[model samples]
Target: MKATDPSQPRERALLVQVVLGRRDRREAEDSLAELERLADSAGAATIGCITQRRDRPTPGLFVGEGKLVDIQLACREGKANVVIFDNELSAVQVNNLDLALGIKVIDRTEVILQIFARRARSAEAKVQVELAQLQYLISRIPVSRKQQRFQGGIGMRGPGESPLQLRNAPMRRRISDLKRRLDRIGKRHASVRKRRPWPLVSLVGYTNAGKSTLLNACTQAGAYVDDRLFATLDTKTRLVHVPENRKLLLTDTVGFIRHLPHGLVASFRSTLDVARESDLLLLIADAADPGIATQIDVVHETLAEIEAEAVPYMIVLNKSDAATQDQLDHLLAIHHDAVVVSARKGEGLDKLKARIVEELLAHDVHFPGENDHG
Candidate 1:
């Protein structure tokens, strides 16, 4: 099959499946909706979503054989060209699914990597994404090395390069080279931050969590706010007026997702530097979502992975108009500093801005501009 030719017809339609292990059906549905968002981000028109509830995935196929057959039938009926799994699939799983379904198969990790690959604008971002893709490809190398011998340098290797020649030793060297280049970029960013005396506030949370909406609400930064996941792939900083018209830089950053590939986290580290260096972080949670807690945990873990957890942050529960009282109460108990707001309706926005000012002042009270109200 050469791993490139398609046994099935290729088109735009996609069949997305959400894999739930020990999570409630409601949560699974919420996560499935997120997968649809990812598909939309990747330019796939989602036809249907299938959720498989299992305590554990099948060894070879992500879902049980019966479920796989059912999904295959659905794909055939829908004439879908792409099948996206909510979980990260092993290389063998991807190959097995491609063989069984005879269609292009992509897991959540691949979907995210695709977004990073597309949204990366700067050289640093590009390098980070390539490094992450290489790391991911390194892990997912098929067991059939003979078949993959032809696929050499298809993923991890640079333009027209072959991995067979360098083998493991040279591959490690390239990884090290990428790290050193990223370090230089990081140091330059540190120098820029040191020059700015104004406090920095960062927006962080699950992808499509309306962090961009809030950023626009407060700063009128006009950050790209599409309904799709990872819409704001690159972080953009704009000066925002807090309480009393006080100004501070607000950075809208990349959103996090559950089970995000480690390669992605590593590659986006430079982009996520804005979040790590912020004086205050607004961890936005989609209040309208049923799986808000799980999404929050994903963001927290990602922050920890980037060593950004030490930065003081408050929860911004977005989409409050679509949220129920129970959901709001449940989240409020855990995040006392959290504020529920609908960025779409402009409701609770004043309070959210006030909280941002309070948090910023708690750390340091310095008027960057002419006003001095100490």
Candidate 2:
């Protein structure tokens, strides 16, 4: 509600979750906790949280009328200016909720899209994020255009300087044009890959699991790294040099997350396709996260969804410096074959590199000398 700066006001958000059948209270809490992190990543301060048990989502509102009233009271009492839903909401549902709550209402997918829109730096990533954003907004346009609209921040931020909401006809044209442009970009990337004479290896992991940090540690690629979720959206390939002058191409890719939207998966396939093409994948994970196993499972599920399951992968537990000895041991004991490293502190990287060399050699590709990857 406070806005000294119109373009970048601090959002005070109320987190909401609906517990459907079969998902217990703990699971719902875990999800809400994750959503809170997402809100924080989008530069919002969480002011309150509300959860409701529902047999099924009410047709127009995700929550029951009583629960909706409860939420209204919470929003006023807690002074929340925004509401972020853990579950995906229909466009109509979002519209109705916005009217009822008297604030911005966005679902999980929109939050993820907002992060992608802001994090995208390269031309390719920008294109992918834009196309995805357009696809998402095309459906929400009719509902949004009818409303008196809350402006600027989170779901409102997107590619370029243009206004986000556009006419359906023009927006469809934009989506098609973006798809074609992305297709060309994907083909160009493929052509470049064909020209490169080294084995391809990509780093895949949950968001903010230190893939870029590992990349910088290994190849000194100086990739952009941030502590927030979805920090690096661009695909960066750098040549990793091992002993005896043998080298392989290493790529840092966008990180995966639990419940990553299906639309995002389709839209960013051009970027994610790198993992599918790789001879080997370094499945990175944060050693400190108690949810490390679940995060690893999500990455594996995403890889399978992208048809990258056939590719051989090694689990690399990174950020060992942040993890307690007990945590590290717990992970290592569970993942006996896993490589441990602190990409930020430059610890255990040599051993990780040695494993990489072994894995790449197993694929049996001859490396050419002194070529810096792009």
Candidate 3:
């Protein structure tokens, strides 16, 4: 699909999803809601949504023919310019859908890539986003080329190469270049980490779970905080002082979400290494979000995927000021050792820091000497 024009108004999006079984109805709805948030984050206006239940997806269009007609009519009624599917669409599926609906069709992965592309600020982040985007596009090039050929656009390609080859070659080269750049940056980051004297502590949690707020409150690092999914892409590290004039390296990392793209995880492995290498991890979670338990599970699963599951860590139930007493009690019952804190209102921060000091000291974690305070 062509990139939406920034000069034009935001494209209206119609979200589509398929419920595989009766038991998956709630999960499918939640996934669709998240896709809507992703669309909003990518600057798309959601005009409507459609859901279909099927024992399994249709190989051709994903959704059945009758559902496609309903979607087409809904698109006309809502004036939707784009169709966003909750599930990952295969290249052939994307091609068929575009031919059937006569509109841009994308899946959950593309929406996430779009958000990452827009939110990437640092050079390393930009490189990582581009690499993932290139990889995703390369996977779909075959079907795209087939469609182009059917439309008689193959003859309009550059003189020496077919359309597919012309598009894929440069993207492959770009991916190689990006990898080289990222490797250099990763080496630089590793060297710096080696020279640092403080024990590293990384804050990890679901997006919009107040990890950045806690980082700012604890370290006075002034990291940007936003109440949006994947608000912080770049890792921010700061020196935080505890009791006895001891200092620790506190790092804030990009948040995890349910069903995060594997490509993104691989591409951001360098950044995520902070969590993997940390002496202690502060698993910050929102106390008020109804999906907090599931969010915690997703964070844990992501950590395990990155080989950080065995790292010593502490659970921190944040946003205590906003959570009801019953909510706090319920979470504490489940995570008995967790420290409750409100990073935004400065509630329970001292307790959290004290807990941090206790955990690090018990583990005999390293700290800079007086002369190494810088």
The number of clashing residue pairs in each candidate reads 0, 0, 0
lDDT per residue for candidate 3 within 25-116, as digits (tens), equals 66677678888888888888899999888888999999999999999999999999999999888988999999999999999999889989
- Quote the positional error of residue 23 for candidate 2 in Å: 1.3
In the range 82-139, model 1's lDDT, one tens digit per residue, is: 8888777888888999999999998888888887787778788888888887788777
Displacement of residue 163 (Cα, Å) in model 3 is 12
**Local accuracy of candidate 2 as per-residue lDDT tens digits, 1-374:** 77577445388888889889888776577678888888888878898888888789998989999989988998899888889999889988998999988889999999999988878888988989888888888766544442434334558655643344443568778888989998999999988988888888899999989999999999889998988888888899998887767778999999898889877898899999999998889999999988888889999999999999999999999999999999988888989999999998999988987888787767664457533351
Candidate 3: what lDDT?
Answer: 0.88
How would you order the candidates by lDDT, starting with the best?
Answer: 3, 2, 1
Query: In order, what lDDT does every prediction score?
Result: 0.80, 0.86, 0.88
Full-model lDDT, candidate 1: 0.80
Better of 1 and 3 by TM-score: 3
RMSD per prediction, one decimal? Answer: 6.9, 7.9, 6.0
Position 204, candidate 2: lDDT: 97
Error (Å) of candidate 3 at residue 320 is: 1.4
lDDT score, candidate 2? 0.86
